[model samples]
Target: MLLAQRLPQAGTRPSWPRRLRAWLPAVPALLFLVVFFVVPVVEILQGGLYNADGVLSTAQFARMTHTPVYAKVMLTTFWIAFLTAALSVVLGYPIAYLLARLTARARERWLLWIMLPFWTSYLVKTYAWMLLLSKTGVLTTIASHLGLIADTSTLAPSMMGVLIGMVHAMLPLAVMTMLPIMQGINTQLVQAAETLGADRATGFFTIFLPLSEPGAAAAGLLVFITSLGFFIVPALLGSPKESMIAQLVISSVLELFDLRFAGALSTVLLLCSILVFYVYDRVVGLSSLSGDAPRPKGGQGGRALPVLLAIGRAAGKLHFHRAGRVPGNRGLKLYTWAAVLLLVLPIAFVVPLAFTRSPFVAFPPDLFSLKWFGAFLSSAVWQAALWRSLAVGFSTAVLALALGFGATLALSRMSGRYSKPLFAMFIAPLIVPRIVIAVGLLYLFARLGLTGSDAGLVIGHTVLAIPYVVVTLSASFKRFDWRLDDAAKMLGASGFTRVRTVLLPLLASSLGAAFLFAFIVSFDDLTIAIFVSGGLNTTLPKQMWDDIQLAVTPTLAAVATSLVFLVAFVVWLSSYFKRHSY
Candidate 1:
């Protein structure tokens, strides 16, 4: 009776210490982000609000508003981002749709091709576009030979070039974003619609399209936000008139030496991104990114449904009247294959160009030679950059995985209102622009005397990598069978023993994948490296950026080709392990 009285009641709340203990595991990761990510970003944003004397003022914002060039640049930035998002969605929808119809194995195989461009370094891809769109390049040569144009002065340094590069970069992402939602859709609904006297077009438009809207919306939002911070594509392929807000921010810092203006520019960009994210969350729900259908809120179905249904009815009316006719499948397949080809073309072109005897990066070599590859191998600068990238990537992956694993595990064990907000906080890095983070880190690292150091690069990359790690582990945890743990516990296994023998074994593949993703994120990073390297510590991407800006040579192509092969091998090895592990 005394023991029963000593026990807490069923409805009694846990003690404060118990609640605090529940959050203990997550504290390290939370503190890390608060210190490195949140503090730096907040400080930079605050910089924009204060004057040179540290007095709070709106002069920076006033300058942006009053300056015609700044206003034009901001407008141009949004317009380009909007177009990139729209085009990526439009071009990627069919590919995602085709993949959705395939079997799991086939889908996985096709995704290999789709993900190649995504895995390739942005610098490599941008360089490849430069080669293709140059005056004496492959495409221009072909066009010239075919008598399509009288002038052969190249198609680059134009908005068309900018769009091509940006869209190519973003298309794979769009396809990936929409694929999960499309796969979760019930094709049976489309079949039912067809059975009820609707044509194929009508069924797809009314049922499948409506169901896929959330994914499309999510992709658009994500792509637009990502595009806003793009400096590489525009800098390489676009003229000054096509300069983006990111370019202006870069110029303000590097060329103008105006930290205040850079901060103000970053503030505007950050606020715009946050505003867009907020609207997307309220409307489509950010959960759409995870393939979950959002609950319909009030007024969600008001006019959009009627408009979509009307479009479906019109498409149905225009359908060709033929028995057993499955329209668009063949076309979709061909389109998907073409898209795959586009994704691989640049990488394919770079490989052969790496072996060219010519000094320049041009297609159709006069003779084959390995001189450029030899140059790359023998150059101390190149070797240093390569090793530095590997080191930073390794460090970033380890740090991110450790932090993400602990935080994810803690969140998985807890069930409360706090979980959602914490998860959102963890993933905020993904939503925020990379350029903003880069500039912010530059400011913070400068004050701490950590700028231009390997540690700075690792810290910045880890911030970027944590989001990918958290998201990957979160999904893996959700799909895990907790019953195994329960069974092990009932069998008298200790917590350590169960985790070591059961949980770790079951989650090994996911952990490896998350590590690989984090590594790749760090390795492929240029924005952070550009700001953090400070010309003292050069990463592979930073080296490539310098070479591309100063001089484009066959050696650059050789380096790019090597990176492609390395990334491909890594991806293949990962796939092999995953396949054999099962």
Candidate 2:
């Protein structure tokens, strides 16, 4: 009778209480996201769909459609974003390929250069570009000296300048995304093709290129989605005609005081972003972004093989052939060096300008001085902003790590049916535009009296930071040997003891990496600070924005240089932990 009772449940599911208990570890993170991210975003979308009297209406959306200026801005935003993604992918592919071919140690050395701009503050990079692209700036002066253009010609305040800055900002991200996929490609496939009488160019084009398409496509999608919400680069580097939808949304709120209209604009952007994300998820799977090899559907590559082979034949025909000869490696190395130079040139210029004696931010200083650094050190406002950023960044790192660790652990134990959806939910913050999150939180925080408070800043930054934490931790957890926990348990260790001794020690490197990423995300944030800080309590990035808008001086350069050093120190510390963690 007891056997019958146990066997009789063949068609039945687990009890509701049992299922609920299974998800208990994830409850805290789920609740946090629901309260801070989902609820606020829904409220913002609702605001756009209703009038002041709370009656249902679409007047705001109607206004958006009917206004020619708004229409132009939407078109411009998409166009620029599309171009940025396309160019970033194209330009980053060679670098990713080169890095993929290098030895691990050599690749790491090169990656430091690639990631330098990524670690530097976006505001700092933008300002450096400003100095470089200005009429009398370094690039223009150099070009004029070489007779590349008239002495008065400049790059800034134009679409060309906007593209240059945007592509520069996104190139590192594209390379990082593609490099993993490229590295995973089997070199044997190309060697086999060459052994079968195919030339090197033919083998690379027919086999390697097709294999790397997924990575390139993934990189393009990510860059495009990220570029859609960019306001800082466009606002600073381009003219009014180049205004993006994000800029418009900011204007509607701060300048026009039209919350309803701003909500509508954000809604349009949110929907577009969601649509793109949906398409990417269906085609490549969102898991690709987190380092999973996306499964290509059956017959997908078969359909493209013929076209690729044809292209390969054409490429082979164009290759210059000589007896016992192959192309030189020096061209690839030169291209890589040039790309690295472009990435570091702006920061290199800004550092020197920071130490210049001139009050003006000139590239070649007449004399060296430390007055700008002194100014930054002595200013009460700068000190407060720096401290505020550090505090919020640390708090955000702790909170995000706690939530992400629990959620990731819970997900590891859950079934795929339950876990995949939850994983998607966790990473959704990354897909949604920062401006949308910022605008939604601004409304939610205002009603809760949390604006201008440090707690509010921490919460906002934590929401953004959690995705990074989850991604970093998930990669480590995927490869972790869970049997260690079982071994500890078998030795009569309790849950807490097993976690403290077995899990923590094993995962220290990943934990440190996750913590550093979360901290950097919060530290470099400007969108959330602009909305949640309310100008009264500013973070470092927000303060920099205010200062830059008010006046451009050597002081800004000094601040940028300081930030570069801080990031360098943080990176060095992370490396130290990694080296010693074992």
Model 1 scores a TM of 0.94
List lDDT for all candidates, in order: 0.86, 0.86
Residue 71 displacement in candidate 1 (angstroms): 1.4
**What is the lDDT, from 0 to 100, of the residue 552 in candidate 2?**
78
Q: Highest TM-score: which candidate?
A: 1
Worst 10 residues of 2 by lDDT: 320-329
lDDT of 2: 0.86
Off by over 4 Å in 1: 1-22, 144-153, 298-303, 320-327, 492-496, 577-582
Which 10-residue span in candidate 1 carries the lowest summed lDDT?
2-11
Per-residue error (Å), model 2, residue 469:
0.9
